[model samples]
Structure formats: C-alpha cells, structure tokens
Target: MYHTWMRYFTPSPAHHRLGLVCLGVGLQHGALPAVGPRVLDHHVAVVISAGRGWFRGADGRRRTVTAPALLWLTPGVTHHYAPDPDTGWDEAFVDFTGPATAAYADLGYLDADGPVVALTDTATARTAIGRIARAARQGNPFLEVETAAAVHELLVALRRVRADTGADGHPVLQALARDAFQPLSVIEHAARHGMTPAELRTAVRRGAGCSPKDYLLGIRLGRAKELLVGTELPVAAIARRVGYDDPAYFSRLFARRVGTAPVHFREQQCRSVPGGFTDRIPDPSRPPTIPPSAPADDGRRGGG
Candidate 1:
C-alpha cells in the first residue's frame, strides 16, 4: 500500500549487518490528489517541489507554496497540504532520523519548524537523494554515515544559495564568508584576502556598506548568539571561545551590540525559549581576544 511519512527502524538483522542504517530517504509525489492530513514519527520532509498550494504550516501560519520549496517538519507536527486539483506538483523528499538531525538543526539547516529555503537546484539535491536511496536499498553497512554526509552536503548547498547574499563580490568578504562567525579582525581577514588593512577597509565600505571591523563584529555577535542559545557553556567560557577574553568587556560589547547584558541576554533567551549568559572577567593574560596575527597585504580588493 502507498504510504505517506512511513516510519520504520532497520530490523535487528539489518541493524547488525548495517552498523548504522538508522537513517533513510524516500522520494514521494502525487498527481493532483488532495494531500491528506498526516503526521510523521521519524521523518523530516523537505519539499523539493510544489505548485501554488494553500496550507497551514506546523507553525500554524497559513502560507502558499508557488514554486519548489523546502519544508522541514519535525516529528509529530501535523502538516496539511493540498495541491490544485487540476495542476499537480512534483516533489522529491527524503526521510531521515538519527543524532545528526539535531546537528542539522544546530547548524540552522533543520529547525523546530519551517524549511531552510524555498528553492534549490534539483540536480544537486538528487545527488543526495540518490546516495541515500542506494545505500538504503543495498543495505550498506555505512548507510547512516554515507547518508549523513550527503545530508550535510545538501544543507551546505542550501545554505550557500539561500544565505543573506551580502558576501558576494568583495574578495575579502567573500573569502571570509565561509566562517563569518569566527571573529577575525579586519586587518587579519584582509591579509588573508591579500589586501592591506587600509585597502580592506575601503573595499568593505564600497561593497558591504560597512567597515571591515563592523562586519567582523556582526559575525562574532552572530556566533555569540548561537552559542548563547544552543550551548550550556558558561558566559565567560563562551566569551573566550568566541574570541573575547574579558567577560565583563564581552558582556558590554554584546550589550552594546545586542542591547542587553550577557546574563540578562541569556535569561531573555531562555524566556524566549519557544523561539529563537554572563561571567567573571578573567585576568587578561595578554587580553583574551582574537588578535590579528597575520601580516598586512599591499594589494587592493579589485587589483589583480
């Protein structure tokens, strides 16, 4: 019988034979049939295709999908979707379960609700789907490992394509784009991009509409917020981890940028738990900060 969001574990024998067949992906679609109300126990659906359709998302938000969209549905949430009775939509989705689910969520790919993006290249997505299918059908011993890797690639691709799109053009921002949260100083980042500090600042203003340092601060704050919410690490430890040394100064900086002290921020974050930390200032054993260690470059952003 054709099923929607079917859930099953790799049988004991299969589990033994396959060290980690814990994850699986299934491709599904229908031709203009009204989608029934259903919920899944072990699958997160990514909508690879959809025509204009009316539905209430797990978030209880009424929305319409006109083109290919990705929907990340957590287990147990009721998802109701219906396509135009006349025009059917094509869709390819993979069911996955395992520890990696949380990892994807942490990376901001999968979330408690909503798809990471609306549209993605079919060719790129199929590579991941095909790999998962092959591994599952063949009962590969490393199915989870292989499938997890493929899923990672899928998430990275989706993220790259759907990201803010502000890191393009400027060679420096583009180069530093990969790890925008790492808190590298402008001069150091510029040096890496083969530009001197002055040239780097100029190019950033021209392209990103902000100074290189401001851009770096934005990245650092983003990372700080992520760790602040996702991790149980103490504020001081978290601060140092994100290239800050003095917890007090870090708190001040975070407050200045984020509008609240670190402790209050953490409390606020917890209060906002349904949605989307402080400590002692450690002795500055040489200022706990992400100092620019690289030498400056002489080239400019556009210079060859």
Candidate 2:
C-alpha cells in the first residue's frame, strides 16, 4: 500500500517578493496512478526520491524517470507521468508560479522542453523538497512567506546541481556571467579565457544555444527591462545604465529586439500591475536614482 500527503496554499499578496510562490506541496510513497496527457495551468516539479517511472512530454516522447531525478511540468505543456505499478516510487512535488520561474527556464536552470533531469545529489534535492513540504504542513500564519523562501532554496539547489554536472560549459558560462554587463567584445571575452574567437563561439553556442553576441545582448536587455519597469529613469539614463552610451541607438535596438519601445514597455507593465511603478517610485516628482557606474565601453563600438 502507498502513503500520500498533500497541502494546497493560497498565498497572500506579501508573498510575491521572491518572484516565486508555492501553490501546493505533496509527498507520496508507492505507486502513482496514471495521470493525464493534459495541460496544466501552473508549473509542477516532481522529485523522485526512490524507484522509477516514465514521463511523456508534449513532444510525445516517453523517457524513463529514475530515482534522484526531477520531472518538470511547465504551464500549458501537455505531460503525463506515473510510477511503475510493480515497483512504485517515493516522490515529493511542489506546484508554483511567479515571474522568476520563467526566467529560470530562459536561463537554462530549468528544462521546459526536456521533462526529466537526472540529479547528481538525490539527498540534497529530497531535503530541499522536504523542507518546502514541511513548511506547507506547518500551516503557520507565515506559511506563504516560509514556503516562498523554501522555493527559492529549492531553485538554488537545482542551479548548483546543474552547474556541478555541467563541467565542459562552465568556463563560457562563467565568463558571460562575470563580464556580460561590461563592454567586452566576444573576441576580448574569448581572449580572457585563453581561447580563440572561434573556440569561444563554439563554446558559447554549445552552452547557451546562442552566439556570444546574442547572449551578451540578452543580458543587457534583461537588465534594461528590469530598470525600465522598476525605476522612473529616462530613456537615455536607462540605456547608459545597461551599458548603452548612445540612447538613440539603444532605443532602436530595444524596439527591434523587444518588439516595443522602452517607454511603451514600461507603461504597459505599469498598466498590467496596479501601483507597480508607484510602489517602486514613492515620489513621482523626484528624479530617478542612477545605477552604479558600469564599464564605459561595453563593446558598443565593436558591435560584437
């Protein structure tokens, strides 16, 4: 026979700071009944602590899911998974949502396309999930806050696991993380790591699934978006903050890459979330605060 326990949570408004919110948590031991090849509205992370199963993703591919693995069920993605009837499994799962969840997927921390991720440290993953479950079960007045913090811990654990297992791609990713905001060209970046430009290109492409230039631009754009929404900075100031010297060129690039003007994007975000801008900017009359100084070049001239 199997044992199962689960809890669903309704997060309060204050729980939104972590950029991720726990909707529910569940723990089960033993066989799982076959679940649908249907879509879900929220993301569910199923961590298998023991035994085995099979997972089918939207692509209709069935992959064996062994213990110490994670099966990610992304929102609107059709998926079906279940433990072997004969062997069963021990599983812990958390349902969650928030802006940062999508960002994680984009950053390759979570695999939205591939459903199963083999974990190097099963105990660590299990412990993190267990903490989330325990917090949910406690039913404290601060349940939302506690669960949210635990969810962040879970994500950090996942990131560390991914990094530990990904040895070959580490240097390129590290370089990008360290210097992406600066004005270093791809060639200069490559040279810093004692690699040729072509070698660097190959490494970045293999690691990030994008060219070095594109990856760097993505970093710049992401920061620009954050600045645009969170602060009342002018277009030029926002551009410079994100490493762009010429505001006009930055505006053009932002429009082309992001599908909207910077001002429009900020306005749209403000409209979507009530008081988002006002909450960030307490006094409308005051000038926007400037970000710390960045490298002056930012490889803008090289256009790499």
lDDT values, one for every candidate: 0.61, 0.80
Q: What tens-digit string does per-residue lDDT give for candidate 1 at 1-304?
A: 2234322335345333432233456665554455446787765556555555656656667677665666666678777776555655655566656555655564455656554346644556666666666766455666656666666666555544442333134456676656554546666777777889998877766555677767777777777887778677799988887777778888888999888877777677774333332344568786556677886676754655
Clashes of each: 0, 2
Residue 137 displacement in candidate 2 (angstroms): 3.7
Q: Against the hidden reference, what TM-scores do the models get? A: 0.48, 0.61
In terms of lDDT, model 2 sits at 0.80
Worst 10 residues of 2 by lDDT: 271-280
Model 1's lDDT to the true fold? 0.61
